[model samples]
Target: MCGRNATAVYRFGRPGRVELTSAALTMAMRGFAGGGETQITAVNKDYRYTVFDRTSRTGFGEGGRHDTAMSSGLLIQRAGRTVAAKACSRDATVSAKAQAIIKPGPYVPH
Candidate 1:
């Protein structure tokens, strides 16, 4: 159950705290773009999380909510599909989560 905040592997995405278990991987994204944590379970590998344009203490609860105008559920670039990861000489089951909000800003794409 021991965990600490650290930079993401190869800086592939936002930095966060990592907590590992025999059956799952937990990461709580921190800093300006951080809102909640993403948990990747071994059984499904589905990352249940909430992150967005603005910080909110209310996290993604029970996977029974919808994306608001300001926030969206987690986005994942699963392992074996990330090209930047291979170029960086890192090979592992890496998962990335990006906040998908519809707004014109650095977080959103044109």
Candidate 2:
């Protein structure tokens, strides 16, 4: 009936649409840093990311804080662009999860 092309959303090898854009990362950072209304400070000239250690947090919704695991990732931005990122996990998983949604800019390292 309808045609759906997942390829448009995916790029085999080296990712073409996954990494976060500079603006997206900046907005997120600003929101988290200044309550979504305050001006954000410049930490660096190049895009930098702070990786978070993901391992699941306790339980949720009446499950009681017994034991649960969760994975997490931190967003980093540079002068409006996200360049590099680091996480407690491997690049493969990160690359897969993001699924080429944003697409790294040209001249970016593979």
Candidate 3:
């Protein structure tokens, strides 16, 4: 697989170093508020994953050993829903573990 990240159709889970648009984020929140569930799949060749969301249910891995990470195992509040993902890579792929949420400050980047 190439060292650079690849972009493909947005799928739940297996969330790679992918970014979500604010509009999409809003929709996700709305779904949660409306008692709807959303799913996302991540595809990076190295590791792919699938994620499911629900209003009544907590973010990914709410059962045990909660790891708040943004990539696949990320858990953060967006729009209004608490999102979490599970991460996994190919045996040949290596990945860095990171926190899902980065507290925002007063300053916004341009």
lDDT of 2 by residue, 38-67 (tens): 111113346544333233335455645345
> Model 3, 1-110: lDDT tens per residue?
11223222333334574343221111112233324333333333333333333334334564663433222122333443434333434212112211112111221111
Pairwise lDDT winner, candidates 1 and 3:
3
What shift in Å separates residue 17 of candidate 3 from its native position after superposition?
Answer: 10
TM-score each candidate. 0.22, 0.24, 0.20
Q: Of models 2 and 3, which has the larger TM-score?
A: 2
The all-Cα superposition gives candidate 2 an RMSD in Å to the true structure of: 14.6
* TM accuracy, model 2: 0.24
TM-score ranking from best candidate downward: 2, 1, 3
lDDT per model vs. reference: 0.28, 0.32, 0.29
Q: Distance from true position, residue 33, model 2, in Å? A: 22
List, residue by residue over 24-67, the lDDT tens digit for candidate 1: 33333334332432322121243222122223444444676533
Off by over 4 Å in 2: 1-44, 60-65, 79-110
What would the C-alpha RMSD of candidate 1 be, to one decimal place? Answer: 15.3
